[model samples]
Target: MANFIKPYNDDPFVGHLATPITSSAVTRAILQNLPAYRFGLTPLLRGLEIGLAHGYFFIGPFAKLGPLRDSDVGLLAGFMSTIGFIVILTIGLTIYGAATFGQEKSSGNPNDLQTKKAWDEFKGGFFVGACGSAGFAFICLSSIPTFTV
Candidate 1:
């Protein structure tokens, strides 16, 4: 049987966290065969998954907090909040990445190169995921007419 859970030693992000596991054998097998996973794009894929879920589920609650509770206005607020979140996250991650990058460069470890590459991919994936999901949500939500002619 193929291992569904990634080994902790192989996953730098697994610190203090449970190893990732597919819920079923079929899902694990299918995902394992995907080019994205093969190419180490799991971070990007995970980011997209997280962003899409956040956009769908949190937007409504955010919209509720908008002034007058108008649908269009609420949606606009939600969209803006999404943008703001992306910006903030980007800045924070950039700082974290920079610090890690410097440490990895100085560590003199043979595996640092691979770690750096993975970190770069993770950052790119996170940015793309946030932007893509936010853009999609904006397009979908903005199409709803606030007032009928």
Candidate 2:
């Protein structure tokens, strides 16, 4: 029978407070899997690459325009970080769904349960990258001096 439920190992800490850690683990598992890795790479790399690109393009232009307020910086960083995460989750989930469909189609057994597991892991991977990015952005943005001039 297909296990429709997403497994999170029944750990309270993992279930409540540490989604990023779970996400990273899922991402790692997906990456380690030879077949799924190829499909997963697009979004994984995209999050990092686009985040860097956005920072480079927007920061300099904004700086050149004038001195930015801390709020402005926070808003910009948060927006970009959020967008990057959105991209990661959207793309990752799409790929995961497609892969799951493919797996189901290829198998003769209609009761295959691994498909659900794969989906859960992919969700975790996406969450992991998104959380990591958000945390990093928060820390970096928070450190900026809120100089009230």
Candidate 3:
């Protein structure tokens, strides 16, 4: 009993998670563990790269326009609508990330952002952040006619 128990306890999360592992399963596991840059470096780089792209997209308009027209309701609304998307999305992601990393997003506290084991989930969040910026910018650009003379 102890002999089998030791092997079973090796990795509580993964060991015996599946059994009767097949030839293709072995091949797939080998492929996933392959030391290729595509699987390893790319995900890391892509997450940071997409984050940078989103940050630039967020900052570009502010630097050019000096500041958004907060006093003017129309421009303010549009501008807020534009940036609000980014802010909320970023905050939401931070919340989720913190949760995954076992931390809190509130309390005005300094954060230690730890990447979770779920790379796929992180990638999805990164993509959503980028796409939200793009979509909000597109909406703001398209709605300009009504705001202008």
Model 2 residue pairs with clashes: 23-124
For candidate 2, lDDT tens digit of each residue in 54-103? 33333333333434434456456544546564666557766767675654
Per model, state how many residue pairs clash: 0, 1, 0
lDDT accuracy of residue 109 in candidate 3: 17
Off by over 4 Å in 3: 1-45, 48-76, 103-149
lDDT of 3 by residue, 24-99 (tens): 4675687666432234444434555565467437544643354543444534454455456566766776567666
TM-score of each: 0.53, 0.34, 0.30
Q: TM-score of the candidate numbered 1?
A: 0.53
Better of 1 and 2 by TM-score: 1
**TM-score of decoy 2:** 0.34
lDDT ranking from best candidate downward: 1, 3, 2
Minimal lDDT window, size 10, model 1: 105-114
Off by over 4 Å in 2: 1-88, 91-116, 146-149
Residue 44 of model 2: what lDDT?
A: 39
lDDT per residue for candidate 1 within 68-133, as digits (tens), equals 366546677877776777778767877877776755643343223235555555566666777677
- Rank by TM-score (best first): 1, 2, 3
lDDT of 3 at 9: 33
Better of 1 and 3 by TM-score: 1
Q: Candidate 2, which ten residues in sequence have the lowest lDDT sum?
A: 105-114
Query: Which parts of model 1 have CA positions greater than 4 angstroms off?
Result: 1-43, 56-58, 103-114, 144-149
